[model samples]
Structures are given as C-alpha cells and as structure tokens.
Target: MAIYMDEIVKQMLQLSCKLEHTVLNSDSEPEEWVLLLDERQYLMKQLDEGILAGEVLSDHQKMLLAQIHGIDQRLQPIMLERKQGVEKKLREIQRSKTAVDAYHEAGPSAYGAFFDSKK
Candidate 1:
C-alpha cells in the first residue's frame, strides 16, 4: 500500500510539473490555448476524484502541496491574460457597435429635417 501510494504521488507530481510547463510555455495559437485549458480541467477533475475517494497519502504530502501551489501560481497569469483579452475584445465589439449606431443615427432616415439648401 505504501509503495502504491508513493507511485500515485509521483505520478501526480509529474502531471503537475507537466501542467506548469505547458502553462509557462503557452503560445498565442487558439488551439494551444484550448489544449491548455482542457488539460487543466482534466487534471483538476482527476485531483478532485482522488480527494473524494478518501485516499490517504502521507509520504509526499508536502511535496504535492508545493507542486499544487506552483500550479496555482501558473494559473494566475493565464487567468489574468484571459481577463485582459476578454476585456479588449469587449472594447473592440463596443467600438464597432458604437460606430454602426452612429452611422445609423446620421443616416437619411434619422429624426431630423431633410437635407435642404439655405439659399
């Protein structure tokens, strides 16, 4: 049982390290981002399942905790970048909508007198 626990902890640690690497080296490609998020979600689900299963891991508790912290550290920057990207996209969409509305407001059907020469 002890050896099995150690192997499980080792595998979990490896996965955490891999996840951190993936997050740190992420690129601008959309598919890469999707892959990163998918990996994160999968890891999180697996961890949750393990916790729910009441498995007791005593040997590498501190090390696993540290790696989990490291993973969280990597998560912060990615989340911040995502927030900034979404905000920027929202600003762009708002700008586009505003321009369209302004054009419509100044169109010929606008609520105003028709074009007339002040001769």
Candidate 2:
C-alpha cells in the first residue's frame, strides 16, 4: 500500500507540474485547471494522512519520494516561466479588450453592426 501510494504521489506530482506549466502558458482550460487542482489537493491529503498514520514505507517508496523531490526542484524555473508567460498573455488580452470596448463606447455605432445585420 505504501509503495502504491508513493507511486501515486509521484505520478500526481508529475501531472501537477505539467498542468501548472500549461496554466502558466495560458494553455490550460478551466477543466484542466480544476483537474490539476483536484489532483494536487488529493495528493496533499494522502501525504498528510499517510504521515499521520505512521505508515511504513518500502525502500522503493523511499527512493521514489526522493526522486520526486529532486524532480520538483528541477521544475521550479519552468513553472515560474510558464506562470509569468500566461499572466503576460492574459494581461495583453485584457488590455486589447479594454481598448476595443473603449473605442466602441466612444462612438455611436456598434463595431459589428454591419456583420450582424447582414448575417
């Protein structure tokens, strides 16, 4: 059970890292975000429960934990870059939307009146 749990934790962490990066790149859909958050929360809960239960880990599990820690460390910069890039994209989109909205609001005409009327 401990070994399985260790494997589960490793897989969850890897998925979390990937999803986090995706989110950072503005590539994460709402569903993906939810799934990633859920997995992270579940893994945290499992780790806490396992620790509280004083579970005995096999050698393989111990090794896996260490490996996961190392992988997480290596992923730090990638995670940061992804997050910053996503934020920048979102900000750019928001600024563009605001500018367009302002342009439309300043005029009496609706920007898409022609296309809407023809369709």
Candidate 3:
C-alpha cells in the first residue's frame, strides 16, 4: 500500500512539473491543456481513493503534494485568463451568427426606392 501510494504521488509530481513547463514555455494550447487536466483529474481520483482506503502519506509524499499545490496556484490564473478569452471569442462568434441570420431573414433590399418629396 505504501509503495502504491508512493507511485501515485510520484506520477502526480511528474504531471505537475509537466503542467508547469507547459504553462511557462508554450502558448497554452487548449487541447494540450485539456489533456493534461484530464490526466490530473484521474490522478486526483486515485489519490482520493487511496486516502479513503486509509493510506497515510509519508513526509516525502506530503512534500510532493505541496509542490503540486504550488504549481497549481501558479497555473490557475493563466488558465482562467485563457478560458475567459475563449469564452469571449465564442460570444462574439455567436453574436455575429445571429446578425447574419437576421440579415438573411430580412431578405435582399430593393435596388432603388422613391424618396419622399416632403418630410
């Protein structure tokens, strides 16, 4: 049980390091971020299961968890910023689409129209 716990913590640590690298060194591509996040979620689930099973973490494991938490703190703001940007872009696209649909519904305008002599 201790060995299994150790392995899980080590893998989590490695993933956190990779996430930190990705956050710092690249453009933070959404696809890559999603994949990493999915993996992290899975590891977290496993960690939770281990804890529920009464597995106690050693000091080293606790330190690794702390390091992961620190990395997460560094990554959170950047991720939120990126998410907001994406959402804003999506809203803009939706608005443009709505305008286009309304225009289509309105149909084409007359080529020419008579002007009123008196207003």
Candidate number with greatest lDDT: 3
- Compose the digit string of candidate 3's lDDT tens values, residues 3-32: 998998899889888887887765768788
Clashing pairs in 3: none
> Scored by Cα lDDT, where does model 2 land?
0.69
RMSD of each: 6.2, 6.9, 4.5
Worst ten in a row by lDDT for model 2? 110-119
Q: Candidate 2 has which clashing residue pairs, if any? A: 24-82
Off by over 4 Å in 2: 1-37, 109-119
lDDT of 1 by residue, 1-119 (tens): 55555655566566666656655665544456567557656755665566677866574665776776777786778767866897899999999999667666644743665433223
Deviation in angstroms for 98 in model 2?
A: 2.0
Question: Which candidate model has the greater TM-score, 1 or 3?
Answer: 3
CA lDDT, every model vs. true structure: 0.65, 0.69, 0.85
- Candidate 1 shows a clash count of 0
lDDT of 1: 0.65
Q: TM-scores across all candidates?
A: 0.54, 0.58, 0.80
lDDT per residue as tens, model 2, 22-107: 65665556577667768877886887788778877668767766765675676577656766877999999999999777666655
